[model samples]
Target: MHSFFVWYRVNRDEGDADMVIRGMMARLACRSGVGGRLIRKRDEPGLWMEIYADVADPARFEPLLRQAVDEFDVEMFIDGTRRTECFLAGDAIPAICA
Candidate 1:
C-alpha cells in the first residue's frame, strides 16, 4: 500500500481554507473510495497537511486527487505549491532495513 502526505501553506483566511479543504476531502472520499485527514502545524496554522493513508492504488488515486483540487479551486487558498510525498510499507523493502 502507498500512503500520501501533502503539505502546503495557506495564503488566505484559515477558517475559509479549512472549510473548503474539508469539503474537498469529502468529495475525494466519495469519488476515489479513499478517505483523507487534514491537519496543521501546532504553531503555524497557515501550514496545512493532508494525509491519505493506506492507498491501495496510487495510479488511480493521485489523478483523482488532482482533479478534485482543480474542481474545488483549492489553489486559491494556498500559497506556493502543494508538496506531496509517498511512502511504502517498511516490510515492502525489508532488504534495505537489514
Candidate 2:
C-alpha cells in the first residue's frame, strides 16, 4: 500500500493534458486496482495527478512507471512532481488526494 502523488506541469490546453493523464490512468487502474483523477488548475496553469495503489512490493512499479511514460507519451517538456507518502488505510486519506 504505497501512496504516490504526481503533479505535472502541462500545456495549458485541457485536451493536450489528457493524453498523458489518460495513459497513466489506464495502467494504474489495472495494476494497482486503484483509480485516479485529473485536476486542472483553477487559478494557476498546470495539471495535478495523484494515485493510490496496493503494492505487493513498491519497487515493482519502477517498470510500470516507464511503461506509463511510453503509454502516456510524456515528453521532457512535462515536468513531473512526485512524492511518495506512507502506505494507505481507509480513513487516513485526504479527500484532496481522493
> Root-mean-square deviation of each candidate, in angstroms?
3.8, 5.8
Local distance difference test scores for all models: 0.92, 0.61
TM-score of each prediction:
0.89, 0.60
Query: What is the alpha-carbon lDDT of model 1 when measured against the actual structure?
Result: 0.92
The total of clashing pairs for model 1 equals: 0
Once superposed on the true structure, which residue ranges of model 1 sit more than 4 Å away at CA?
Answer: 91-98
What is the Cα-based TM-score of model 2?
0.60
List, residue by residue over 17-86, the lDDT tens digit for candidate 2.
Answer: 6765676777867875656666656776565655545555557665666577666666543665443354
Error of 2 at 36 (Å): 2.4
Candidate 2 Cα RMSD after full superposition onto the native fold (Å): 5.8
Candidate 2 CA-lDDT value: 0.61
